[model samples]
Target: MPRPLENLRVVDFTHALAGPYATNVLAQLGAEVIKVESPHGDLFRAYGDDRELAKLGMGIPFVGSNAGKKSVSLDLKKEEAREIVRKLIAESDIVVENMRPGTIKRLGFSYEVCKELRPDIIYCSISGYGQEGPMRDYPAIDNVVQATSGMMMVSGSEEDPPIRVGVPAADTYTATMAALAILAATTQRARFGTGQFIDVAMMDASLIFMYGSTAQYAATGAEHKRTGNMGFSGQPTSGLFRCSDGHLVSLGVVQHNQWVTFCKAAKREDLLEDPRFNTIYDRIDNAPALVEIIEQLFLTKTGEEWERQLSLGGVPCGMIRTVSEAMELEQVKQRNLRVPLNIPGMPNADLGVLGTGFLFAEDGPAVDGPPPFLSENGEEILSMLGYSNQQIADFLASGILQPSKKPETAK
Candidate 1:
């Protein structure tokens, strides 16, 4: 009946998306993740509320990344709060943080501090860059990282300036990587009885994604230009086509033989025989004409029809479904991807669009807790640590264990 990470305790000092995301994955697999937050709380709660106290707990991002964890509000600047966090560390097996490079050490609670408290502690730091890179100190968001890592430059249409992805992809990807690394390190610790400090960089993950084109461009001295919907593999027929219903389907005829199947499916056998569309290079050169032809052909059917044909023919293709559609798909439903999350005191709490990406494939307990109210458990937590009610009341009065209250109450 035990989960993969049953009984393991985690001290989560992460916010926004990346660091919290990693620990949330651990929480899903049965670790106890205590999320320590500043007094005002993670900035994302305001992302939905626009700074009003009534709007404080509205966290679309926070809900997605922080489900199945306990939230504790503590101003680490205060010595009282820091001491409480130290107590939590004494009972924790993992500690995750996503502050700027030196913020934790400056707060007087570095990896060394945690290691001294718990020798087998696994400490993870997820930042824009690794802890010691020349660019480590620079604060970065997902779009900024994309631009700096050259992902934006190669991600757009040829006619437009570099465009950041519509989603915070770098943050999400790096967070997934961080989770994998933490799991790997935890696995190693089972044998060695030693844990390590893991440093994950968002920019580094972006660069790795661009490695293929970046490496080719480096050796060839040629810049890789954007080809709109055209994929980088130089597939002549790999582009999005609009159906009569105003929907799109990504058709990738990457293989020469797939091209024949695609042409036959589209009822365009003459294009196959046409010398202008014979080879991959020729198809790339004649993509404009090819697109025109395909567009005209696609207008005769709907996106659903093309998806069926493409799927049946074993051609590489995907229908451009909306987020709702994607969420409702059979595969997604089967995977239990859209987990129902109910946070405490929220009207309707559901925290998962970009849920845990590190799937184990084995049937197991998923992350299953409502996001905690800020410092809601402080008194209980301290009591569990042997602090009496009077000690807890003193800490509460001093604002050491700050807990959020109803909107009409004090600040």
Candidate 2:
């Protein structure tokens, strides 16, 4: 089965999380993504403390986000390497970069240069702020963007210190948004017969993700408060509760009907007649009392038991699960969210990575292969560009192209 973006060619000049993640999405959708890296390679290759994997040129962080793409290592500081990149841009349909505002332009491959090479190329630049802004040059990563976007303020309890989200929410969301913008630009180019330049800022993407709370704040001129483990509705029953087995279950009794159903399921139908818990407003007003009662009732059953009963009764609820446990779920397996790929040069031949979030009836998103070793495809890429054997060797010897080192065999 043919993939959606099989015909598209991408010259990916991205590194670290945000940029690489966006190109990964494009690669999963079947685009030919050529990931160009600097002489030292993407910093993410040495992000974590896995020295063993790093020695093998397969750091977990790098492998997780960079599968299904070819790697081409080039020292952009060298004129010869810059010429090779220009040649690549001339043949590609899209170019993506996530560097400081003026860095790419200084490298001589800015939007203007790419447009001159490929008139209909889609050029996307992801950054901390934007191309033209006061803070455009400010350095930022996921945690910094989270703090600046007020995301840290809205997480955890109001009394707790501001906490960064456990996952790299800013980077991940920015990548997702960048991919969406790139696709939109592709569509626009198809219709208008001209390419476009896209500017995606991590801070801007984080703010967009908080649109609901921002809208409320704008309309009421009041700030949204942090409510730990609770829904924005603030219903007494819509939060995490500890069960008898010491596990937690998250309940989301939003609608009036769901509240009534939850009461019946937990044998707390008496709550229906109580004046303080009768209406949504009353429940919100007397959430403390109602929560105390629900906590006692939940303590009577294990989290799994309550999950079964509540789901059977049509109340939205789920048991809190660890990452490993969540992945082991039968439903998740059925969705094929985790897939195995045989990555070359790695000890584990059948390692698994996540698949695309959605499925298609036919050929959909897929991991084409394991993440490439640094410049694993450099020779082949240059050859395809009409470079002769001697020229390719010269490029390698001059440090214009650095190929992956062969894995050492056991002594």
Best by lDDT: 2
The lDDT per prediction is 0.80, 0.89
Off by over 4 Å in 2: 406-411
Q: Pick the candidate with the highest TM-score.
A: 2
Candidate 1 local lDDT, 1-411, one digit each (tens): 677898999988888887877787888889988878888877776565423422756567776666677777877888888888898898989999999999999997899999999999999998998899689899998889988988887776889898888888888788888888889989999988998999889987877767777787778988787877778776657888899998898988887888888878766788888998898888878978877888898888889898988788777888998888998899888877777765444555434444454466564758676666577566777888788999888878888888554333222
lDDT of 1 at 210: 75
Model 1 TM-score on a 0 to 1 scale: 0.89
True-structure lDDT of candidate 1: 0.80
TM per candidate comes to 0.89, 0.96
Clashes found in each candidate (C-alpha, N, C closer than 3 A): 2, 0
Candidate 2 residue 323 Cα shift, in angstroms, is 1.1
